[model samples]
Target: MNKRPSILIVDDEVSNIEILSAVLEEDHDIYFATSGDEAIATARAALPDLILLDVLMPGTDGYEVCTSLKGDPLLADVPVIFTTALGDQEAEVKGLELGAIDYIAKPISPVVVRARVRNHLEMKRMRDDLAKLAVTDALTGLGNRRRLEQALNIETARLALTSGTLSVIILDIDFFKRFNDLYGHTAGDRCLTMVAAALNRAVHHASDLTIRYGGEEFACVLPETEHDRAMDIAHGIRERVEALNIPHSGSDVAATVSVSIGVATAACVPGATPEAWVKAADAELYKAKAAGRNSVSGRTFQVVVEDARPLSSTA
Candidate 1:
C-alpha cells in the first residue's frame, strides 16, 4: 500500500490551524505548529512532504521560517506553500522569492488547498525519483561516483569537527580487463554485479557506504573507523569475492575471481579534505596492485597544520 504523504501546517491563529488541519488530515498525516519556532522543530523532526506556512506571525514570522527551512540540508528539499491572508501581489512575490513553491491566499478554500497540495506532492515525488536516479548506478545498483564524492565530503567534514577517524577502501577486480576480453562483456558485467553485491554485504555498518567508483573499481567509505578495523573489513571483502568462485581463466593469480584492496584512514584535523583522503587510498591501492594482484594494503595518516595538509603515513 502506498503511504500517505505528510504535511506540516504552521499558523499562529488557532482557527487557521484547525481549518487547514481538517482539510488536509483526510489525505495526509497532519502535523501543526502555532509558532515559527515550533514549526521549524516539527518540520525538522517529521520531515514532512510539504509545508503550509502562514506569512504573519508573532516571532520568527513565516518568511523567516521558510528561509530557515531552505537553508537546512535536511529540510531544503521539502516543498513549501505560503498560506497567508495577505493577498497582495508583492506579498506573493516575496514568499516565492523566499523559496516557497506556491502561495495560496486565505480565507481558505478546502478544494483549492487539496488540489494544490496534491499537485505539489506529486511534483516532489518526481523530483526525488530523478535525483535518486542521478546518484545511483544502473548496472550494479550501488551508489555511483557522484554520490560517493558527496558522501565522502560530508563524512570528512563531520570527522573534522569530532576529531574522529574516517577510512576509505578502494577495491579493484584483479585482471578485470583480461576477464572481459576472454569471457565477453556480458559475463564481465555479471562479474561486476556479483563483486558489488559481495562488497555491499561485507560492510554491515549502517554508516558505511559502498559505491561503484567507475569501471572495475568500487569504494567503501567507513566513518569513525580505525586502521585495524578497516583492514579487517578489506580482508573480509577479498574473501567474500573469492568465495563467489567465478571462474577467471585468463588470470595467473587464482583459478577464480579475486580482488585487490587499498585502505587509507584519516585521524581528521581541521584542514582535512575528501580529495586528499581518496588520493592516499589510491596510492595504497597502487602499492597493492604492484605487490601482485590479490591482496589488501592499508595505511593511516593525519592532517597537519591549519591548511589541512596531509602528512606521510605513520603506518
Candidate 2:
C-alpha cells in the first residue's frame, strides 16, 4: 500500500490546529507545532509534503518560518501554505514573496483547504517523478550517467568529512560492437538488459549504485568499501556476466558474452576529486582490454591529508 502524504500544521491557538487536523487527518497524516520555531524544527524532522502555517505566532512568525524552510537545501522544495487571519492583499503578497505556495484566510473553508492541498500534493508528486526519470536509463532501468555523477559527488563529499573508503568499478562488454553487428540491435539491447539485471543482483548494499554508463559500458559506485572487497565484487560481476551464457558468435574471448572490469579504491581526503578516481579505474580498464577482454584489472590509491597520490597495485 502507498504511504499517505503527511502534513505539518503550525498555529499558536490549539483550537486552530485541532480544526485543521480534523479536516486533513482522514486523507493525510498530520503533525502540529504551536510556534514558528517549533514549526521549523518539526518541518525539518518530519519532511512533510505540505506545511500549513499560521501567520500570527508569539515568536518566529509564519513569514520567518517560511524563510528558514526556503533557505534549507533539504527542506527547500517542501510546499508551504500560509493560514492566516490577515485577509489583506499586501500580507498575502509578503507570504508569497517568502515562498509560500498559497495563502488561506482564517475561518478557513474545509472544501477550499482540501482542494488546494490535493492540487499541490499532486503537483509535487509529478515533479518528483520527472526528477527520477531524468536520471534513469530507459532501456536498462538502471541509473544513467547523470545519476552516477550525482552519487559520486555526494559520497565523495561525505568521505571528506568522514575519511572513509570509496570504490568504483567500470565494466565493458567484450566485443560488443561485433556482437551487435552479428546478432542485431534488438538482441544487443536484450543483452544489455540482462547484464544490468545481473549487476543489480551483485550489489548488496543500499548505498551502492549501479549505472548504465553509455553504450556497452557500466559502472558501480560503492561507498565505504575497501580495496579487497571492491575487487571481489568486480570479479563477481565478471563471472556473473560470463555465466549468463548470452551467445556472442563474433567474440574472441569466449562463446558466451563476457566482460572486462576495472576497479579503483581510495581512502578519501578533503582535497580528493571523483574525476581522478574514475580516471584511475579507466586506466586499469585499458590494461584489462590489452591483456585479454575477459579479465579484471584493479589498483588502490592511498590519499594523504594534503595531497592525493596513486599507489598502484595490479590485481
Candidate 3:
C-alpha cells in the first residue's frame, strides 16, 4: 500500500511549527499540536507513524511527553525524534536516553530534517523486515527450526549462568506416510500447510517457535520452561491438529489428525551439549510413540559428559 508518512509536530512556538511543517510537508502528512495535551490527543486518535516534539514546550515538556508515549505499549514502537533549540551534547543525550530514535536541532535545515526523518523510517522498515525473515520458514510461512534452536540456546545459556530451567518438544504426525500414499503428494502439501497454521495458532509466546522440522514432523522450543510445561504445549499442539478436522483416511475415527510428541527439560544439566539435549528430546519422543499414537511424553535429565572439559568453563 502506498501511504504517506504521518508526523505529529509538537511545539509551543507557532513560528517553529510553521517552519517544520513547511520543511516536512512534502514528504509527510504533517499535524501540529501547540501543547503537549493536544499532541497526546492527536497521537492517540491518528497514531502517527512518527512524532517530532520540541524540548522546551510549556506544561509537560518533550521529555515528559516522550516518556508518556513510550509507556503505552501501542505507541511504544512509534519512533520519536526531538526537535529542540537546545542543541548541546546534554540535550541530545537526554533525548536519546528517553528512547528517541533521532534528535533534530533547531534552525532546522529542510535537507537535514528530511534526510534524518527518511533515514529513521527506512531503518525501521528494514529492521521489521529482517525480524520477520529471521523467524519465518520460507516454504511453510511458519516459524523455522533455526528460530527454535535459538530460543533453546538462549534459555540454556541463561540457565548455565544462573541455574534456571529450559524445555523442548519434538512432535511427529503419526502414519503420515499413509497420508501421502492415499492422498497423493499435492494433497500432502496442503495438509502440511493446514497443520502448520494450527501449530502457529496454538503457540502463545513471541519467543516460542513452531518449526516444520522436516517431512511429517514438527518441533516447538520453549525457554524458561520445564518438562511438564513442554508436555502441556505438546498436548495443545495435538489438540489443535485434531481440531482442524482434517481427514485421515488411513487412520481410525474417519477424521483424525494426530501427533505423538516427546518433550524434555533441564534445570541443571550439570554438563550441556547440543547432542545431549537432542538425544534426550528424541528419546522422550520415541517413548511417546511407543506408549501410544496420540499423546505426549515428558522427560527431564541432567547434562553431563563433554570432550572439552576444563577449558570450556562456559559449559
**Candidate 3 local lDDT, 82-122, one digit each (tens):** 99878689888988899998888878988999899898888
Q: What local lDDT score does residue 233 receive in model 1, on the 0 to 100 scale?
A: 97
Best by TM-score: 1
In the range 1-315, model 2's lDDT, one tens digit per residue, is 999999999999999999999999999999999999988878867889999999989879988999999976457889999998878899999999999999888898999999999999999999989978988999999998888776776677557667899999999999999999999999999999999999998999988999998899999999999989999999999989988999988999899999999999997777676676778888888899999889999999765444443222121
Across residues 181-235, which tens digit of lDDT does each residue of candidate 1 receive? Answer: 9999999999999999999999999889999988999999999999999999999
Deviating ranges (above 4 Å) for candidate 3: 1-135, 252-255, 268-271, 305-315
Error of 3 at 16 (Å): 24
lDDT per prediction? 0.89, 0.88, 0.77
Give the Cα error of residue 176 in candidate 2, in Å: 1.5
CA displacement after TM-score superposition, residue 156 of candidate 1 (Å): 5.3
TM-score of candidate 2 to 2 decimals: 0.72
Residue 89, candidate 2: Cα error in Å is: 3.1
